[model samples]
Every structure is written in structure tokens, then in C-alpha cells.
Target: MTIQQRKSYLIQVGAFLSQFKSSGIEKRLDLACNDPFFDQMLEQIDMAVHYNGWFTRENVLFSLEEWDKALSEENLEKWLKSYNFQEESKTVGLVMAGNVPLVGFHDFISVLLSGHKVLVKLSSNDKKLLPILANYLVSINPEFSDKIEFTDGRMNNFDAIIATGSNNTARYFEYYFRNKPSIIRKNRNSVAILTGNETQEELKLLAEDIFRYFGLGCRNVSKLYVPQDYNFDSFFNAVLPWAHLMDHAKYANNYDYNKAVYLMSEFKLLDNGFLILKEDPGFGSPIATLFYERYTNKDALLETLQAERENLQCVVSQDLMESEVSYGATQHPKLWEYADNVDTLTFLQNL
Candidate 1:
């Protein structure tokens, strides 16, 4: 496909998304909620925007605009034209994760845009959403249909590979994709450093950083580094208004289970519905747990974080202008950037 061809495809997708209420995608999300496989994933997305009140209609529209513009002709002409091909057909295997909504969607988007075949192994935890979205793409232009496929079996025929999983799974991917050109995603935690001077409203928004997706995503805030002698009570109070969400059976289950385990083993933890409060220590990932430590010296904390930068993807704290990652944006990843540091279009271009 040429630049113009990809442009046409993106514009069509843009039109459908921009007019989502009138398009099948919105209806698709509604109908997708029925799938037992995706019911939980659907609930998380809907509730994240609602419970925290982050996903306004305005935000929804903004997402469509952003996605469209990211894939627009001008951007693609610059960003993707060199990546496009005429008859090149590489079987790119994709191993996706369900940590958050469409966690590995960029792999699919890149493979499709670059005219490559995909063998996607959808995470059992999130199987339905991607297929539904892919159906929309295939429906838009059936010819592009042959360019994509989904699979869970061995990707021995794959010419290249991309897999998203935990640090442990990365070991397996390293062994598996050793013989193939591959990009493997490893476990990384996101953190936030608080100055403790934020407004009540700012603190409330930061709470969203912890609770969204029940803190299961890689981008969700897992550990918070705060100034010395900070008041944890005030932060808790600011977020207390959202206590109703704790009643959610799924979230409560994780909270209760973790709490019980902590009590039994005396792991030293804090409790607040879906989040566990810890004075220090960054859990491997933020799933259903929020922890923080006090640090008066920003310079000292920055040095500590930088030393461990290899294992970190994002810093979810206030704009320190020193951390490599953005705070609170653990979720809103653009189309071009894949997990952590992998840039898909750039990879394809250099390939």
C-alpha cells in the first residue's frame, strides 16, 4: 500500500470513529460487553471514565481525533511512507496482553498499516475486544483482510515477533524469539512523586492514577514518592469520596484477598477498598495495590529513580521535569509508541 492508500484507510477509520455514536464501533463496544470474555474489560473502561469521572464525552471525542490525526496522511506520509511496502509480506507474530484496554493494539495497528501479516495470540483475559475492532477494519476494506490473522499456537512461520508480558514471560520470549527478529515487552512499574502541595482536586485526579483498571496496568501508579513528613490521611480523605467503587465485587475481591494474605503473613500493608496502602516498597506492578514512600529531597529521589531507570517505563508523579516518563499519562499511549521505548513505525522503517 502506498501513502495515499494508507491515508484513505485511516480517513475511513477516522470518519467511523469521529461519528462513533452513529458508527458500528460504539454499538460494537455495547455488544462486546455481552461476551463473557470481555465483560470485565468493558466494565473497567466504562467505570474508569465514570467512577473517577475521567472519561467525559469530550475525552471520548478527543481520543478519536487523536487516533485519527496520529494515523493521518500528513503524519503517515512522514511517519509511515518509508515504512510502507508494495509486495513485501512478513509474518509478524504478536503476543498481546490484557493488562489494560487494548494494551497491545499498537502491534496490530503497525502490522496492518505496514502491509504485513499478523499471527496475534490474544490474551485469554482480553480476547473479544481486539477481534471486534479487527472486524471493523476488515469490513472497511476486505482486501486488507488477507493482511492480518490471529493465532494462539506456535509462531514458527513468523518472520518477526512482538510479545507483551511480564518479566518472567520475557525470559521465555527471549528463548522463543531468539531465532527471529522480535521486540519483547518486560514488566515495568510506574511511579509518582508528590510535593504534597497539590490542590484537593489534583489529589482527587491522582487517585484515578491508582484506581483505574484496578491498578492492573503497567502505566497505573504503583508507588508514590512523597516529601518527608507528609500527611497520608489528607490524601486518603481526598479520595474517600470514591469509596463506593470499593463495593465493586471484582475490585473488592482483590482487595480482600490481598488484605487477608497480608494479615496472615503480616506483610505490613494498608487498606482502602481496591488499593492497599504501603509506606514504602514498589510492588512488581500496581495491580490492586498502591504504595508510597516519603522523600523530602527531589534531587535525591531523582538520582535513585534514574539509577533504576532500566526497569521503569513511566513516572506518574507531578511534572518534575526530571523523570523520563510523564505522570498520570500511564494510560493514554499514542499510536506510534509501543510499550516502554519501542517505536513501531520506526522499527518497521529500519527493518
Candidate 2:
């Protein structure tokens, strides 16, 4: 299929996705293949929730809503304008990550849009959603039927590979796909730099960045870099709205267990019933807790952040650095905001 054909098919999928919202699913009669695929898509989302404890209905719908915005005709055109597509197609292997809903959809689409076929190995945590979406795309055009394939076991017979996993698994990917063109992603955490001058509104928005998806996605801010003598009163108060998260059984269990361990270890902690703030230098934090470090010198902190860039997926801040993600905006990344700062489309185009 031509690039234009691929783009058109994807835009239709985006329109279909736009119908599913957090409030409820609204079936639009005008949508193509609405009768057959619309209800099936909804059932798949429900199945996803039953299959994975982390795949809450609200979170899954939020992911779909974000993609709906991303695949709009304008956004798609603007994002793809900078890339040149190749005429020949190759088979691209995808080992998807299931930390969050539809986490690997970007790579899936990138391969297709670059005029390549995709062989997918779905993460068990997120197996249902993508295949149904792939089917929806195929329903849009029968030509897409030959381009998509999913394997539950080993992934092979592909020209290139795109895999996401922990740092340990990344090493294995590097060695295994050594001779092939690939993009191998590793563990990354997002952090926020607090200057002690943020508005209440901004701090509240920052709470969204920290707690959304139960702080499971890489884009979720798990750590904070605060100025020396920074106070926690305002920050804690601003994030009070998310206290409802404590009602989630899984999250509550984690909070209880971590709180017990912290108390037993006699570590200093600032707790507000639902969330805990601990003074730590680490970027990744446990569930129900956030790590923070104090910096007295701005220049020193900048140097440290620059040095540890590979360990970070995003730096949430306000006017602190170039390319820093704004408060609460990390999760709603644009289509071109490639993960690990690696350009997937560029990788596919070259392949």
C-alpha cells in the first residue's frame, strides 16, 4: 500500500478511537465497519481489564483517547511531513512492552507507515487491545490483512527488530539482534525539577504527572529534584485530589506494605495518608512513594541531569531547560515524541 493509503487508514482508526472516552463509549453510526468492530473493540477493552490487573478501564480508555488525538489528520500530516518513505517493504519484528496500555502502538504504526510489514509479539499484560485494533485497521482496508501478524511464542522471520524491556533484557536484545537493524529500549524514569516557585495550579497538574496510570508508565514522574530548603506542605496539599487512588486494592496493598517496611527501617518519611515522600537520590520510586533530592547549586544539578540523561525518559519542569516536558504533559506526548529519544520512523525509513 502507498504511504497516503496507510495514512488514510490510520486516520480512520483514529476517528474510531475518538468514540471511546472516559465518560463512556459513544458508537458513531457513520464510522466504517462500526457495527462489527465497534462492539468487538469495547469487548476487547473489557477483556484486557480482566486479563491484567494493571489495565484498569479508566486507564485503558485514557490511552485510547490520547491516541485518538495523536492520529488526527492534522497531527499525522505534521508528524510525517519530515520523513521520506521507501518504496520497498520489509518485515519488522516488535517485542512490545505492557507497562501501560497500548505502550508499543507507536512502533507498530511506524513500521506500517514506512511501507513495512509488522510481526508482533504482544506482551501478555496487553495482548488483547492491539490485535483488535489491527483487525480494525484491516477492516478499513483488506490490503492491511497481509501486513499484520501476531505470534505468541518466538518472533522470527523479520528483517529488523524493535524491542522494549528492562535494562537487563536490553543487553540480551543487543546481543541477539546484533547483526540486524534494531531499536532496543531499556529502563527509564521521568523526574521533575521543582524551583519552589510553582503556582498551585501547576503543582496540582504535576500531581497528574506523578499519579496517572498509578505511576506505572516511564513518562510518569517518579522522582523530584527540589531546591534546598524546599517545603512539602504546598506540594502535598495540591496533590490531595488524587487521594482516591488509595481505594484501589492493588495500590492500597503496595502502600501498606511499603509503609510498613519504611517504618520498620526507621527511614524519614513525609506521609499524607495516600502518598509518601522520601528523601532519596534515586530516579525510580516504589508504588505509593516518590523519591526526591535537594540541590543547592543550579549549575551542578544541570550537569548531573545531563550526565544521567540515559536513565531518564523525561524531565518535567517549567522554564528550567530546553526540551523539558511541561507539568502534567509528559503522558500526552505527540506522535513524533519518540521514546528513549530514538526516532522510530527514521530507523524504519533507513531500513
Provide TM-scores for the models. 0.80, 0.98
Model 2 ranges off by over 4 Å: none
Tens-digit lDDT string for candidate 2 (278-316): 898899999999999999998799889999999999999
Cα error of candidate 2 at position 97, Å:
0.5
Q: How close is candidate 1 to the true structure, as a TM-score?
A: 0.80
Model 1 C-alpha lDDT per residue in residues 198-277, reported as the tens digit of each score: 77877787777666656676766788888877877778877786586565666667677777877798777766565677
Clashing pairs in 1: 49-55, 192-317
Once model 1 is optimally superposed onto the true structure by TM-score, how far is the C-alpha of residue 65 displaced, in angstroms?
A: 10
Note the clash tally of each candidate: 2, 0
Candidate with top TM-score is 2
